[model samples]
Target chain A: MSLVKTIKELKEEIKRMSYGKDISIGFVPTMGYLHEGHISLIKKAKLENDIVVVSVFVNPTQFGPNEDFESYPRDIERDYNLSISGGADIVFNPNVDEMYPDGASTFVNVKGDITNKLCGKSRPTHFEGVTTVVSKLFNIVKPTNAYFGQKDAQQVAVIQKMVRDLFFDINIVSCPIVREEDGLAMSSRNVYLNEEERNQALILSKSLFKARDMFLDGERDANVLRKFIIDNINTKELANIDYVDIVDAKTLENVETINSKAIIALAVKFGKTRLIDNIYLEV
Target chain B: MSLVKTIKELKEEIKRMSYGKDISIGFVPTMGYLHEGHISLIKKAKLENDIVVVSVFVNPTQFGPNEDFESYPRDIERDYNLSISGGADIVFNPNVDEMYPDGASTFVNVKGDITNKLCGKSRPTHFEGVTTVVSKLFNIVKPTNAYFGQKDAQQVAVIQKMVRDLFFDINIVSCPIVREEDGLAMSSRNVYLNEEERNQALILSKSLFKARDMFLDGERDANVLRKFIIDNINTKELANIDYVDIVDAKTLENVETINSKAIIALAVKFGKTRLIDNIYLEV
Candidate 1:
């Protein structure tokens, strides 16, 4: 497996690959601290295309002023090894200067209620950064298909909306969320939690499961389902609920009664770490 | 010359050509009523790229309710012939439905002060539409370079900003505006004017030329230059002045005095037809 570090080199490599007969490129984009969740996306890309390229760059634009951009974990050597083991054809690791040069002024906003709700409420500029960087990577990789994990549900939705809206010719394949044995969703931020905070973070997924149970048992009231999850999180001594709401799955708007598809999403603060989890429920 | 009226056929044909080639595609996006101005853009694209694709879409989202979207003239056959004549490799003429299918709920917005001044004021949604459709076209064509005419100065600026902010890897090439012998800037909306209004429309460009003359004669006061242009437009018997102002060339903010690079722009109403023109000056 080859490791590429510069955008020019990557573009040149991708350009050379495009000349090879019948070569299909697949891409998986992520920030450096790779895990099973990222591996799942890479694996899916590997299965689907003739060549798979994984990009690991900690994008600065996606994090808000108060967000954990500085503390975001990085293990480039380990990530490179894992990407090669997962059958990635190439790993693109661009430095900050390459991805974002001086006087970079453009931004891509996916506009609408979905971007204004959920995680958007706190991290206002998050989706814009994701869309902008992904667009850049798409051009550099020139992939036939790109893989994204469903762990960041809103990010996936926002990207899907952007691709469709912008008429992107590349296919966006979404992989299911990868989780630990105890049902905690795997995230790069998971590394930030201390032992006690990590244990308290489990409640996020548990609350999502509890909401799923309520839906499975034919409870359709969105308010009641949200309250159940919120109350459960409140019971945890270390957990502080940021937001708990049941919204339309597609539009991401708060729904009074769940009639069709709804997503129960929540973000909680465990000590100083912020964790988010959600469950999609269809009635 | 072959014609492609559907996106699927265009995509299929592009895919076939792109299968084993490192071809650099150049895109020229337009609202088709092909004229010398649009042909100039297409010609420039042909000179720069290995594969040149031209899309003729009269995007509806960019037009305001009081604007002339419904009455916008279109002649697809003429446009197709002209595109082929202009050396475009592929002419994508998608219908409204093909570009925007039912239940489409996505939009790309290029934000900041660049979108808050000049043409952005009268046509609030204009830049948004341009950014969205151009973004869509960029994705669809996956071009190595995209061409725009400087006739739409603010639009070229907005798109340049969008490309930078979004991290699109394609080069943005700005071609000179194609003008008539009398120096009236070419535009599709020129078709809406009657002979009398057409004669009066020349004043729009004349005013900008007047400002240029002032700059050449060593007049550097932006407010004075702007007032001179507005006064010139006001003197035209059939023309109603909309806005005449001098602004910073890059940011499009009003300038008190012209120091380095500045743009003098105006919009004038000749009966029902609205005409716009601009001139960039460096002191």
Candidate 2:
């Protein structure tokens, strides 16, 4: 395993590795502060590809004016160890200046109703930022397959749309979400939760799991399922609901009733930290 | 010297040709009315790389509502012969549906003053279309180097900026403009001109050449050079001037004086055919 800091160095290394042979590269892009969610992607990448490259970049463009860009968690030493353990062949950790240099004005955008719902409603420019950085990383890495966690289900859909719309010659592998033993979805932002908030955050998973059971038990109405989840979250005083939506998993469009593939996605604020979670409803 | 119509076939051919042992591809993208201008790009690409791939696509999005997209010239038979004569290895001729399939909504945009000036002023959404299509082509081809003609000076600048901003692992080669024996710059749209319009359109190049000579004789004022070119073109009663300005060669910003590298560019319409020409002033 090697750690490369510069784009030029990384490109040269990739070239050296795949010079006269067929080498399959699996890429996992993340914003530092690694958790089991990130490692799951790397482990899957390692299982499938000859080379696994993981990029840790906390892109500032994805954060809004009032978002936690300045206070976002970052621990590189711990991240490096986790990445090694997860079987990453290369850890490409680039600084902001290296990724987005001066006079960098180009952007890749996936427009239409797809980018205007769910997480995109609150953070209008979030998907644009995600697509732009991902495009750049894809060009730099030239991976055969790129891995993304389904915890960010909307992100996966947007990225899948971009890859198809742009005709990128790479496969996008979406890994299933990883969760803690207590059912709280694994997230880097979990560190922001204090002792009291930590215990209170469990209500998020509890509500989601309860709704999943009801959904399995012939609960088909979107309004009733949405109301149940919202009321359940409101039970915790520290929990402030941002949005609770039951949308088509692929299109991210609202569904009247769940007859096919749907996702119950939500974002809530536990004090200053905002966390997102989702459960897929498959028929 | 194979002509592939689908993106899949072209990509497979490229992969077969470059399976191992270091193969460099040089790409030239064109709308396929193959003139000396496009042939020059292919010739240059042939000299520089192991294989040259010329894409003949008449992109519709670059044309405005009132522009001549439907009447745009195309001749695949003639294009294939010219490409073969110019030493091209492959000719990628994808239909509009192949390049832009159903549900295609992604776009690559280079913002700021670079895309707003020059030809962008008359055709507002032109560069967005150019960048989007070119980015898609780049991803599909994965060429070692891509070539563009300097006749569209602003396009060369915009594409260079996009490449720098997006971190695409390809080199951009800008070739010199190819012209007619009488001095008219070569373009696919030249086919739109009738005999009378053709005779009058020579004024576009004639005025530019005269201005270049005057600038060579120590005329430094940009306004003076601009007026000289505009006056010379206006002498032809059939020519209707669109714009005549002197701008910095790289930045495309309006210049007051020619202290460094500058370009005096103009566009004029004879009948319904809009013709463009430019002359560079290098210190």
Candidate 3:
């Protein structure tokens, strides 16, 4: 296992590893501070591919003006230990300069419906940033299969759309969301929550799980499920609802009557720490 | 020497060809009419790489509403023969539907100063389309080295910027502009010119060459060179000038006085056919 920093070095290592062999590479792209969610992806990658590469880049472009870009967590030593234990062959942790040099003006933008809803409503520039950095990483690490977490359900959809649209010859394997034992979805930003806020954050997953139960118990109307989740989240005095949308799983378009696969996704803020969670409703 | 139409087939062929060996693939992306410029690119690719893949795609997104996308000349048979003679291993000519399937909305855009000037002023969405399709092609082909012509100087600059910005890892080899014996730059659209229009189109290259000679003879003022080319093109009664400006070669920003390397690029119309030409001024 090797932890590389520069693009040149990473490429050299990859070339050395796959010199004469037709090796399959599984890439897990993350923002470092690896948790169970990322480790699960790495473990799955290790199982499937001959080599597994995990990219730990906290892309600055994804954060908004008031967003916690500065306050975003970083613990490379711990991340390295976690990645090694999780079976990551390569941990690529490049600095801001290495990834984005001066005058880097090119952007990969996914316009229209799929990108305009959900997290994109308030964070306009987020997906563009994600797609651009992902493109750069994809080019650098030409993996056979790339792993993503279903915790960011919309991100997976957006990335899947980008891969299909742009003809990226790699399978996007979306791993299930890893959560805490108390039903709170795991997030790096969860560190920002105080003890009380951490307890309040449970409302996100708790509401979604309850809504899932309602959905499974024959609740067909989209508005009813949305109201249940929204009202449930609103009950916690500290939690402020950003959006509670029940949309078609594939297209991310709002579903009126859930006859097919749909995702009940939402975002809420506990103090300054914003958290997101979702549950799929399939018939 | 096979002409593959589908992406799956092409990928399979490429995999078979480079199954266990470290072989370089050179890509020449063209719109197919089999001109000298394209042949030059293929010839260069053949010289440098073990496998050469030529893609003949008449990208619709690059052409604007009033542009000549529908009337664009295409002869796949001639293109195949040309590719064969040029030592191309495979000719990839996927249809528009194959390249851009349903719900393809992602676009790679190189924003700001570089793309805004030159041809971008008249055709706003032109560079976005070019970048998007090229990115898709790059993803599909995954060529070690991609060849381009310097005739579209701005395009070469834009693509180079995109590659660097996005970390595309493929070397963009810019071949010199191949011109007719009479010095008119060779283009697929040259076929669109009527006999009379063809005769008048020479003024573009003639003026550019004259400006080059003047620059070589110590003319530094950009406005003087601009006026000379504009005035020279105006001498032809049928020629309508679109733009005549001298700018830095790499940045594409207008150069007031040519101190270092610069490009005197211009666009003009003969009847319904619009033409472009440029000459590099290097100290």
Candidate 4:
């Protein structure tokens, strides 16, 4: 139930925990405004480790010039209570100056085709920010296992790649995405939508379900499946489609025929807010 | 005196150490040869931290094709003695497999104009390897303070930038270069030079001194200083000049005049080996 604000305090607190020989530490890192999705990640971490530490940081480096960094929602007190309820042992809530000081300059880039596809195409520096912050958090916590939600699919992939490439001695465990009863993916940005916009936002998850239905019906052509999803989203008046594609689940590359594993991912703009949803289909 | 190979064991050992509250951890990473240059770095780390960890990793990622990766010198026992003698609390000597497992894919790049100049020109992938390995070492050790020799001046600058940009919680302490009695900067590569080659290798450092002499004598034109060094190297029949330049110290861009801080660096081929040396002058 205790909240640690600085790296020094956090490290000191972590050292005091009775992490005996072979003790496993679990970590969940999130940009606050904690909802069911973030809670799910923290809950999973709690299940797997002797101690679980959750960090809430709204990193600025991930947002582009035109992106909504200034207006990103935050509620630390609420987040703190939720984290404790979710079974988190410690909550690391560092300020902007604590995580990133004045004149700070290092960056961790997850390179290659993985970074150039999907969400990377729209927000170029987003993964870099995620990777860098994740790296910093990993070093701070030094957890045995770290939990990530599949809501940010590309983020999961980028972090996996970075951990593998860098030889970090920690396990990266990805959990399933949490969704609302209406099938809309749970996200902090969902709070920005009005009642009518919230109703229309359900189309994103519906389009993904439609694609899933096509896969269930034995349709495998990536192009045809992608077109079907795009066409469905295009029909929605409020949901303006940003991108729709069926790509390899692992590589995130556009596959011609979905013979193995494929993912259908799309980003839709519902008024001023953007929402993303994806479904993984395995043949 | 115990040697730990696996990361699991190393972490356990580190956890047992009583790094007192508010105590800083200082790290010095090197490829083992037990040279005075490495010892100098270790001594500095000891002075700066309550606990000192020195990592000896022969990072394969930093070696180029036709470069001496296999033939890289190693004496772990000697290195162990040297590290202990220099006051290093722990020596993290992980093998290549431990550091980089099969099918590793992540890399850390310290970009900008600093990477495009000096040693970067001839060894294109060298800095990438340096940056990547140093990043891995930094993550594994998780030091409060890390030490590097200014012998690799460009590398020190790149690491400083990487630590700042990436938001790693470590202080990068740059120590002065250790030199031989004859003025040659100590490097593992210095072992590649034959007796005559070693003697001829003095020209690399000698040229820097010549540049410094000119700068102290109120020489302002960078081109004239560069020409003087290149002409001096050309006069030595045993030396083949690889690159000679006078550039801005910080940006590494070629300078028209030496009215500001500048670095005069050069690489020379002596028989089959390449030796590099440089001098920074506040002009």
Candidate 5:
């Protein structure tokens, strides 16, 4: 396994590995804090591709002015071990200056109604930064298949749309989100929560599960599902509701009635820390 | 020479050509209606790379609602002959559907100052379309180096900026403009003018050449050069001036006095046909 830090060195390594051969390159991009969710994505990529590359980048562009960009978290040695064990041939850990060099002015955007719903409402310019960095990664990595976790289902949708609309010749493999035994979604930010806050945060997924059970038991009204989830989260101590939406899974548009596939997504704040969770509902 | 009309066939052919070889592919993308200018670009690419592919696409997104998109010239057969003669090994000619699949919602944009100058001022949404399509083409073709004519100098700058920003590992080669014996810059749109209009259109180039000569003879005042070019174009009957700008060649900013490299560019209309010409100056 080769670890590279610069794009030029990474490109050379990828070239050496892929030269004169038809190697299927798989890529898993993350923000340096490796968890079970990220490992699941890496394992999925490893199983499917001849060569696997994992990138650890804490992209500052995706965070808003008030977002937790400065204190996101980083553990290079832990991540390196986890990634190698999870089956990554190359670990690409580029610095901020390398990923976004001086005078980087171009951006790839998915316009219209797609970016205005769900998580996008709070983080307005978030997806633009996501699409831009992903585009750059796609170009630099030139992967045959790319892995993304379903924990960020909206991000999966945005990236899939970006690839399709931009005509990128790569497959997007969306892996299921890994979670703890208590059913809380596996997230790097979970460490920020105190023990009490951590237990309270489980209510996010617990509430979504309750709503899903209700959904499976003949409840189809979007407003009913949204209100039920919101009410459940409101009862938990130290839990403040951010938003609860029942939206079309594909378009991310709020649906009045759940006649088709939809995502029951929400965000909740546990004091200083904010966490997001969702469940896919299908008729 | 392979002539492909579908993206799939083209991709397969390019892949086959690229497999098991250390080959450098050079690309020339253009709206069909090939002339000596486009041929010059093809010839330049042919000389520099191991394989050459020229794309003939009339991109509609770059055209404004009132612009001449419907009337844009296209001659596939003539273009094929010229491209083969001009040293293009493959001509990837895709339809509108192949280039821009249905529900294409992604776009690449260079914001701030670059897109607001020169032809961009007249066609506001032009460079976005150019970057989007060119980005798509770059991905589809996977060229080592891409060629563009300096006739569209601002486009060259925009594309160069996009390539650098997006981290595309392809070199951009800007070829010099090919001109007629009468000093008129060659353009596919040149066919829109009649004989009288064509004769008067020479003033566009004639004034640019006059300014270049004066600059060589120690004229450095930008205002004076702009006024001189404007006056020379104004004297011709049936020619309506659009704009004359003396701008820094690199930044495309207007200069008070020509202390460094500059581009003295102008646009003029003869009848319903708009013609553009420019001259590069350096101290």
Candidate 6:
């Protein structure tokens, strides 16, 4: 795969690809610590498209002031190898300056209602930042179809809302989440944890799966399910509960009872690291 | 020329045009009443592109609560004929509901500095709304080049900033303003004026020209030039000045003395009809 670090170069690359034929382009956008989840997305894209272009931009606008913006992991060589193995034709890796210049000020904000429910409740500006960066990426890439992992579920919902509202002519395919054998959701931030904290982080997905099992055993009360997951996480000494709630799968409003499509999502802090996990509960 | 009122139809129309070939598409976005200014933009688009598409929608978001949104002049038949005569291949005239459907919550906003200096001061949130609508139009039309008249000078600056900030891969062309024989800048809103109001409106362009003449005669002080234009407009019994200023041509910031490039822009009301005009000065 060819590695391009500038917007001009990537655009020229796209122009060269579009020369003689109508080639279907597929894109996967990520912040550059490649994992199995991102690799799976790239593999799916490679399967579906004639030309696969992946962008690795650690978009600063998406991170909060106190978040792990500085400490987020970055290994370009590893990411490049994984992308090429997963079948990316062009790998676009732009720096902060190229993505956001000195006077850059435009932002794309998807409204407050749906965003303010899940992770957005804690990170108020997170989804807005995500939507803005994704909008910029979408415009830059102009892919026929874009691939996104379902690990960031709220992100998928927010992007769907943005695409529909803005009428972007690109299909957004939310691929299934890739998880560890112990049920922990795979994340680039997983690198931040030590052995003990990493083991304790498994409580996140463990509690989620426990909640899922309780629902399958005919538990209907959302409060009961929410309490059960919180209690399980509380048993672990290192796990500090951030939020536990059962919300509608699409609209993300807090549900009192599991009458329709719902998801049980939770976030917890282990030392300085924050981890999130969720499971869809459908009857 | 085909007149499409629905987004689906227009998109399908665009899809048909993109079949097996790479053809340049030029877009001209406008509020319904087509004046010679709009005609000039369309003509430019036709000259520069393989497909010239013009959209006539008086986007409500751009107007202030007190602005004449409902009274904005519109004639579908007149606009359609004018678009065809001006060499347009497609005329997209979507209704208010069609453009902004139910649950449309996303917005594109460009930040303050440059947008805040000129018209943005009087009409806060105006440039943000313009940028949102223009961004949407750019995505929908997928133009190789988009045309805008220099009549709305601040608008061109705002759009340029948005395109740069958002990384939209489309070229923006700012066409020269079309004018009447007596030097009144051509606008769809000009139809709202009575004969007396129309005659009085010419003072806007006349003062701008006088300021231009002063600059040619070695006048460098911005305050002196501003006062000269304001005084000229005040001489008209029916003219009511809204704003009069001399600003840097590129930044739109108020300049004390014009050393390089500058533009004298003003907005005035004559019997409830507002008119704006400007002249670019290079010394």
Top-DockQ candidate index: 3
Task: Give the lowest summed-lDDT range of ten residues in model 2 chain B.
Answer: B13-22
TM-score of chain A of 6: 0.96
- Assess the local accuracy of residue A58 in candidate 3 as a C-alpha lDDT between 0 and 100: 94
Residues A1-283 of candidate 6: C-alpha lDDT, one tens digit per residue = 5899998999889879778667889999999899999999999999999999999988888788899888899988889889999999999999989888887888998886788876888888888788888898899988999999877878887898889888898999989879989888889999888999999888888888888898999999999999988899998899988888888887778899899989887889999988887888987
What stretches of model 2 exceed 4 Å from their correct place?
A18-20, B19-21
Score each candidate by Cα lDDT.
0.83, 0.90, 0.92, 0.83, 0.89, 0.87
Model 3 spans > 4 angstroms off: none
Candidate 2 lDDT for residue A126: 94
Report, to 2 decimal places, the DockQ of model 3.
Answer: 0.92
Which ranges of candidate 6 are over 4 A from the true structure?
Answer: none
DockQ of 2: 0.86
Chain A TM-score, cand. 1: 0.95
What is the Cα-based lDDT of residue B269 in candidate 4? 90
Please give the distance, in angstroms, between residue A238's alpha carbon in candidate 2 and its true position after superposition: 2.9
lDDT value for model 4: 0.83
Candidate 3 on B57-111: residue-level lDDT in tens?
A: 9999999999889889989999999998998999999999998999899999999
TM-score of chain B of 5: 0.97
Model 2, chain B only, scores a TM-score of: 0.98
Q: Model 4: residues >4 Å from true position, as ranges?
A: A16-23, A256-261, B1-103, B113-117, B121-125, B138-150, B160-181, B191-197, B206-273, B278-283
Give candidate 5 regions above 4 Å deviation.
A18-20, B16-22, B257-260
Give per-candidate clash totals: 3, 0, 0, 10, 0, 0
lDDT of 2 at A59: 93
What tens digits encode model 2's per-residue C-alpha lDDT throughout A152-265? 999999999999988898899998889999988999999999988888889888888999999999999989999999999998999998899999988888988898999999
Total clashes, candidate 5? 0
Candidate 5 docks with a DockQ of: 0.80
What's model 1's lDDT at B273? 86
Candidate 5 docks at the CAPRI level of medium
